[model samples]
Target: MKLDRTAIEALLPHRAPILLPTEVEADPATRSGRALIRLDANARIFGALAQPALAHELLLEAAAQTFGIVIGACPPEGGAAAGAEGRHLLLGFDEVEFGPAALDGGAPFELEVALEQTSGPVHVARFSAEQGGAQVARGQLQVFNG
Candidate 1:
């Protein structure tokens, strides 16, 4: 399924400037997904910096959001939405590798995430970010579902 900004906003708690994904593509069955984020001046991380670039933290957030899209798409076993009540928390990052910064040129990037494992409320996913078909970052995110 393809989700626009409004639909994405409805599924996620993040608001604009921080809600990075412009669009999301997800498979509820496989629990894998990809999200597109177009970096512009409006991105909060840019602030007032003359030359803005995609920070590692922001990339991580994007990855987490992408994962959130997947989780939100596939509700829990009982049909309860994941993070519907803002209970999901990013527990940590593992083996995170940062690449070249995405400058403020209205360039679009893609974040892809796949479910790696789940231990109770802790969900682990592997994620990667790419721009112009080149990898910009990769990491594993651990999210705690409440």
Candidate 2:
């Protein structure tokens, strides 16, 4: 199912400024989805969040939040650890590759992702961040149920 902005916000723990999933199209049955992220560097509060809008780094958090949406679709009896709490943690990253800038000025990008339940409460999510028809970054994120 495709989640609108309202639904996406409901499934994610993050809020504006830090919230990266602007739009997400997900298939809960497969624990896969694509998220459109538009970073707003200006949304910072009192310069706390001020920094260069780095797409490669921010893409990782976006991918994790996107995976959370699809994970919400799994039933309690299923292997998904997220359950109904909508609580999950991004543990770490692995095999991350930083590529040339797909575009300057922190252009919006879409990340296609798939998640696998590796073990109890542990999940591995793979994602490809693309912008301007070119890939900006690709990596796997380690996640676990909260």
TM for every model, in the order presented, reads 0.83, 0.80
The digit string of per-residue lDDT tens for model 2 on 91-138 reads 998988867764443467788989855687788988888878888788
Query: Candidate 1: how large is its RMSD?
Result: 2.7
Residue 19 in model 1: lDDT = 82
lDDT of 2 at 74: 52
Per-residue lDDT tens digits for candidate 1, residues 1-146, read: 88888888887765555888889998776778999876563356546522254466677878988888778876665667654534578888999987765543367788899988888888899999988888888989999987
Identify the runs in model 1 with alpha carbons over 4 angstroms from their true place: 45-54, 78-86, 100-105
Which candidate number would show the highest TM-score if scored against the true structure? Answer: 1
lDDT of each: 0.77, 0.71
> Deviation in angstroms for 28 in model 2?
1.7
Candidate 2 overall lDDT versus native: 0.71
